[model samples]
Target: MDGWHDAADRFGVPRTDAVLLALNLYGLQTRLGARVRLQVSVPVGAQARTIVIAAGRPDSPFTLADSGQLFAGAELVGAAVRTDVDDAVSGYLRCWDGTAWRAATINPASRSKCTGCAPCPTSLEPTADPRLDTEDELHLLLDGLRQQLPHGGSLRDLHEITVSTACYESEDAALEAMMVLRKVLRSRRIDARIVLLSSVVRSREAFRWLAEHVGPFGLFLTADCVTRRNLILKKTKADLLPELMPALLADAREAGLDTSFTYIVGLDSTKDMEPFLSAMLPQVTLFPSLQVFQAHTPVMDGLHTPEADEFSYFLNARRIVESVMVDAANNLVPEPWRCYRSLWYESYAGQPLEGPRR
Candidate 1:
């Protein structure tokens, strides 16, 4: 309940804040397997005032003010909710539709505070000494993602892996970590691709070496924001990123390795986003892939959190890329953009690599 309330504060009315509120409340009441029903009635005349009906049995129906108007017939059967919101309204409804929760649908206009109900896993956190080695923690995190793959299946089927290595202080350590990952996958007979975080522009030798050995495989570079000034000052202090990204993408392509860049939304407050799009869209066409930014786990002191609208803008940009470049070639799907070696690597390897790359 508190979690939903906090989120509602951020997203204004006429949005999915209410749906999230209802879902969270329903989850709490039914945690013990007790069936719960929430009926929302909006008065025809009173646009602001709403009536929420919480009925569990014939004996009682609790009615409350719909200040949030979040409860609108989100019910739970013996175990699950009945009037589930469809995909169209799912984003506005905030309810998880049996498969997974949609973070993009969350309204950023609401005024709710995040409760951090689930803290990031300890293994994903930075080390205590800051200067201390993170190889052990990194392995633990990677192993965790590997454990998530379907049991008894080959690793090549697992198409995606998200890593958090972009924030690491040591690029060498990051490269070494990937090497260890490659060794592990080969041992297991799983074929998979890799998305590396952090600016590898300064470490051309390392990246070149990676291209020589792992380059035949897939590689994704994460830059969230497009401009060098903003990325260097606000997001990451690496100035060489802007120049390095294009070069790296070109190098990867020349090396026969599939490559792409990651762009985050809502990083800047400027209204005219066309310039950013202009610089990135061309790359999306020329490059192998373009991963749009979505609000995932918060990082860099919460610098990555984007307004819901901004996130939507990023998604729309991806659509533009798909329609213009990918659709033209019928390569809209990510699989086609992946490196040829990814197929062989995952087939010969086992388990998926996890965590952001540096």
Candidate 2:
């Protein structure tokens, strides 16, 4: 059979207008496993229909019949079959939200309760301005999250609440939002850690303020490249990070907060990150930590497509960081392993810190 063929007949759509997209077999080792989620996206005419088939390991020569219906109680739910031919299948999911079909998901395992609209942990992408949101906006959004949680889930039940401010008006505004959000979560008795994104720590003051208010929050710092030229290309300031990050790390250690760093590889160029890593890793070790690694992805707009060389850069960077940390740990120095987040918690917080929830 063809890798992709017309699905008009099987799905009851017009043959001339419908096409069967790839049947993505996920969680498969070599063949179908004991459990797998089959995500099929078929475009009929101008619209599309996606069916998520959940099932156990199927018989050889896999067929849809082996997969059971996607159930919402006794009623099976899915999108309508379109009649037009579209070449590409957009992976967005559709579900009946009581009244009409809307984009949804089957992941998070909690989304099984999706009744129509998008699920909780609702996205709050910041705008070009901070005042773009009213004071009550965030509280309302949190209320919505509480309402959307699967019947028995509570705010405390969540693992972590990640807030990314990649496009905020200013650092102060982002800081204010973080402070307010911390308060909102605290009032609800939700103990989930709040993971703030890059912009929240744009300056030493902002970083210090964040550490003071949101102590123990996670920092998701994404620096794709450390070179000056690439930093300019990415519209990131050169002096700010170099001067602020180390200082901020020191401050965080003193204040008993945790931070993590992510470096993206293969942006403007692929080369040795050793010099950069060597200079910074020691400073990073001076403070408590979560994670540090080089990640490369093709979906990033201006970055080069990650090829073999890019992969090499990523692997080499990881190897060097791990080796350095290992060497430090093996030495007979007094504070050999006190730089990790867990160490700080063990010494200061009076208890071992648990890993951040997913």
Candidate 3:
């Protein structure tokens, strides 16, 4: 309970109703053994609510104000959630979907062992260091996500699965990681859309190949992108990014993928905000997310601390992007925007996100 509130206070994200149910995912792959269950038994009058679960941490639980938005580790993969609606804390209960008894098990995940990237910052799901986890230990970790659980429900039952292993440092390593999951998912029935967060956008050829072979259905967030200031920081960065970003955004849209940029607020680049939005938002089905630059990152070195007004950033971005919407009058972010679950959208704008992007 203390972990919950401390993290929520730091990040300004909402706290989950966390109950430590005493079950642990102690070396989960060795046996089909551990399952932590939760009961949803409210009056039938409460039937209209949709339940959303947030991953609670036992320690060290925040990245700036991002909250659970930035955590990844082997233990996170071991975090399985079993919604035992019918059981209901040992009394008569009904499932939210009107079934007498229904249960589905899902899990969070960790990254592969390939994890170095200068541009990519660490978050919630961090893999063990390459030296510490032996090849065998690594294999066991992958099995947590690849292997099925001991019931009708599979680990893939997770709504918006985040795959955050260290394999995305290079193009080849990224491909290798995605291929392994592709192979596992080939014959399985999967309803979930896996969001692949990667830093290796080295070439359009590589991205195009991945999109074509992997059948990545549209949506890419160029996380390392900053506007004019980024180009000034390193000219090579200009060649690699700003130009390449919009090109890929256009390419992805042509191929039917929704693409958007990431704006780092408080950077010198925030000056580019209006023009950037005017140009980019029209191309995207989903608007770009403005992230408050924490100023702690290595890339942010030598820059003054951010004096960004987050509420203003959110408001301005919304106003510009809303023009592109057919329903321009709607104050809420449209349902299709994927990053809302983790972003402080509701905190700044006073509107709850419709749902997670899956």
Candidate 4:
């Protein structure tokens, strides 16, 4: 309840609704006795608030909830928060519209996207992504799609295809690959949309192309590192990302793109991560993802997982962002906590993520 109360305080979620959402999340622990963290998809005002579980491992369980594997009804109608506010903040949800930012309303995209084009995500791990360096490799990867589809699925079964900019030599190379991939999908008569994961640290042209042609997909900016000093993409610095992100996100937002930031937690000190997050939090729109670091991965670079208070970092982050940004902006901000858009916030009270409840 206290966790819910804290979330309600930050997100402006009603105590009643907070209690309900908390209970439902807690029910996961109560029933399965398996540890789970609480995560949300958007700010409270939207009519259809999503309770997306990052039930994904760093790249698995925490991502599983939204990765098209479970396909369950991830959207939870908040027991509260929807009202006139839903209209006011609807502009914010335009990013998740999965199509265009200015789109007045968005239908359940999966009905058309998920079913028509089950979305063949042609990918390789981003860290080792340079494998798709040339047209030959890109051609080979797309050609091999037939081998990658599910038991009976084919190219036509795809409504979405994920391409990570992190997996390319340059954003230009990635965009060129998209161009080649687009031609291939078109030739096959497969009308699949591309879901691009970009770091936004690269040249803006690739994303600019995506916004203009692909009709605005959620830009998941991957940073991987999280400390004040190392918070950066390959060559870009922390200072640059914050400045660069808003313009890109705002442009995408104006053009109708859902935007988010992704980082690895437990890779750096949460205390160092905190001030970094505080400085960076307000620069973001959608819930910035904090991927719980997994030790099993080959490259840890000497950091250990922070025993998973990872997600609750949001509540405090909300406070810091609001306090700081508010002082800077001189406004009465109504909603600062995007509790509904993040994970593990409730772990502080009772329902912990992957660990036994307190």
2 or 4: which has the higher TM-score?
2
- Candidate 4 residues 67-137, lDDT tens each? 22221125332232211211111011212332222111111111111111001111111111223434455
Residue-level lDDT of model 2, residues 1-358, one tens digit each, is 2211223233322221112111211111223322232333222122222222112323212233223322222332222331122111111222323332222111111122212111111121111212225437555666655565555545565545655334433567667767777787678886666655453365556666777787546665544345553333233323345435555555654555555454433332334455554444554422222221211111222333344232233333334555555555522111212111111111111222232110
By summed lDDT, the worst window of 10 consecutive residues in model 1 runs over 340-349
Candidates sorted by TM-score, descending order?
3, 2, 1, 4
Task: Give the TM-score (vs. native) of candidate 2.
Answer: 0.48
Against the true structure, candidate 4 reaches a TM-score of 0.44
lDDT tens digits by residue: candidate 1, 118-147? 211222222221221244543443454445
Better of 1 and 2 by lDDT: 2
Which candidate number maximizes lDDT?
A: 4
Candidate 3 worst ten-residue window by lDDT? 19-28
Output the lDDT of residue 347, model 3.
32
* Model 1 regions lying over 4 Å from their true place: 1-151, 154-162, 201-204, 227-237, 241-244, 269-272, 281-330, 333-358
Report lDDT (Cα) of residue 16, candidate 1: 32
TM-score of each: 0.45, 0.48, 0.50, 0.44
For candidate 3, what is the lDDT?
0.37
